[model samples]
Target: MPATPPDDPRPWSIFLIFLRLGLTSFGGPVAHLGYFRQEFVSRRRWLSEAAYAELIAIAQFMPGAASSKVGMAIGLSQAGYRGALAACLGFTLPSALLLMAFALGLAGQGDALASGALHGLKIVAAAIVAQAVWGMARSLCPDTPRRVLMLGAAAVALLVPGAVGQLAAILGAGLVGVVVLDTKAQTQAEALPVAISRRAGALWLVLFALLMVGLPLLAHVADSPLLSLFEVFYRTGALVFGGGHVMLPLLQAELVPDGWLSNDLFLAGYGATQAVPGPLFTFAAFLGTAIAGVLGGLLCLVAIFAPSFLLLVGVLPFWVRLRTRAHLQAALAGVNAGVVGLLLATLYQPVGTSAVGSLLDLVLVLLALVMLMAGKLPPWLVVVTGALIGWLVL
Candidate 1:
């Protein structure tokens, strides 16, 4: 059984917590998820392990930055709309501000980030994600069938390599669960305190559809640069199924050819975004600032992330209710297993492959993992120490 939440935390408290996470939660989206699981699930006990897995499953099915969406969902579940906004702003602002400043020539981190410290940060990402995989696999994929499903999902994701493959794996797992997994065998899942009604959810969905379709048409008709910019980012947010990394090619192709930003500038912002400690979607802030200014950066940042908020708010109410159904619970079990698999695949490709190049890097990762799992040290501490170690030794 999960620990009971003490009380309804105020939005301010949620903001402060998420703000700290935004500052320290390095290593991109997969690593962000790991950090979140540690903070909210393991340490804070705001949600049960099962509930957290369900949130990941839902976020993976959505079309935006999965970690950011998960954060929003956690906020919304705990403290309603205000909490959701608070979480989004708190988690996104640090990197968005940093990237926007970099875009505007107010700060320079490129040369420094190219050093060994960055490599250590990458290693930290690997260790954190490895810990997440280890914990989630034990809890979510306990049985042989679900474990098989987990491995199969990982194989498919590794083989296929993209948003399409990821979505297919989760969807296929859900279908398989509905067929083969026994609902009676599944454990009871705690209900999420998602605060929207079905009618409200439907309205939000309708609004999402309207904006998704209407924005493009409005941009075309008005022939305004700002509207066009908003439309492009909004559409990108609505359409991209994977995480922030997947948005790179789409944004590059759209903005570069359209003359909104030079490819060099776009790539530079991307590199800076990686060096920061929040969602890679904050790259929008960089592009917007380069094109306009601070206001433009804020505009583009909100525009890109707006759809994610809408989709999560719209979908989660019904998702909360549906997951409790016996049949859906079975399917969710399979989806949960698939979510673990997706994380496993991510830990390998980008996290492990990028970080673990040498024997020393591998040793660093193993040491960090031990600290997280056995020593029970906080992830942020490990991350900070890893960067220092890399700066000194690597």
Candidate 2:
């Protein structure tokens, strides 16, 4: 059903495309997923709908930044590891550059006007995620069983709270799915083939595990800033569940007490981050630059994102084969439902609460959502508008 030819898009092409995507793509991971769909599936036709959906399935099932994992999977499926790096780097570069500039004294702790604009940016984030929730619910939670599963998952997420709650909700939903959903439904005729082999995937997984465990111990004993930086960011990337704004607290806790960076500088960088496009993980660039300059920023970037890609590479070869099984498919069904619920819970708590404090804020959220769903304005344009409104009103 796709319009493109069979051959893979050139790796350089993938980089250039993602580079542009990185520069302009705003909002957080959920919105990033939506943006990815626009660029890769709808506009570029880099992947078919089913292919994109399956890739999302895998990315959600893995740990780390969901959007980053999805981007890496796209590259891995298309043109091996090089494509993977290219996509990640391209998507990450703009924010990294801006955040690093902030660290280097080129930017400021934004004034009140800037703060209001950032608040507006936050509202745009909420709107983007709301749209994501609606679309994902329609596509991924279509059936009653899955819909029920999603609601249940959301309740559990709200009740339990935190990373542990999120992981449990997803895992439990997978188990529940195995019992209820139909696994024998037909799959797409042509699933995208991954370039990684099972053995290679396993090797990468082993390396990832080794580093996760080893880096912390080394940081504690060796007294190396590099090791500490790697360990702190790596651990946060590995352990955090939702993987967007939620990372902020965990990151602040890790670096602030140690005096690696000051609280004012850290908060300033975070505010500035709202104006830039790409993953929230690029906050690492700011931290890295504050601690050790541009190279530090780049190193932190690698340390933070590496685990997600490694896990994806490690799991895919095996996941593809196993998910085809009826039981596994059923479990995946539950997991998908649970993820939807988790997103809903997130919307209410962090996304909704943080952004919509007053009547004006609520109006902005509604307007942004309508603009997005009406399909006339692109997301970036809506985001810019929201920022302007925030500056003028909030």
Residue range with the least summed lDDT across 10 consecutive positions in model 2: 106-115
Whole-model lDDT per candidate: 0.78, 0.77
Alpha carbon RMSD to native, model 2: 5.4
lDDT of 2 by residue, 104-199 (tens): 763345354446666777788788667767877897788999999999988987898665677678788889999988868434334566767779
lDDT assessment of candidate 1: 0.78
Task: Quote each prediction's TM-score.
Answer: 0.64, 0.70
Write down the TM-score for model 2. 0.70
Give the per-residue lDDT digits (tens) of candidate 1, residues 1-394: 4576665567998999899999998766878999999988888788889888888877875678789999998888778899999899899998888887777663355445435665776677677667767877897788988999999988887887765677677777778888888875324435666768889999999999999899989999999888888988887787555456546545654787678865445544554565678887898998999888888898899999999999998887677455457777677778778767877887786567667888988998899899888997765578668768877887
Which stretches of candidate 1 lie above 4 Å from their native place?
6-8, 106-190, 320-394
**lDDT score, candidate 2, position 109:** 50
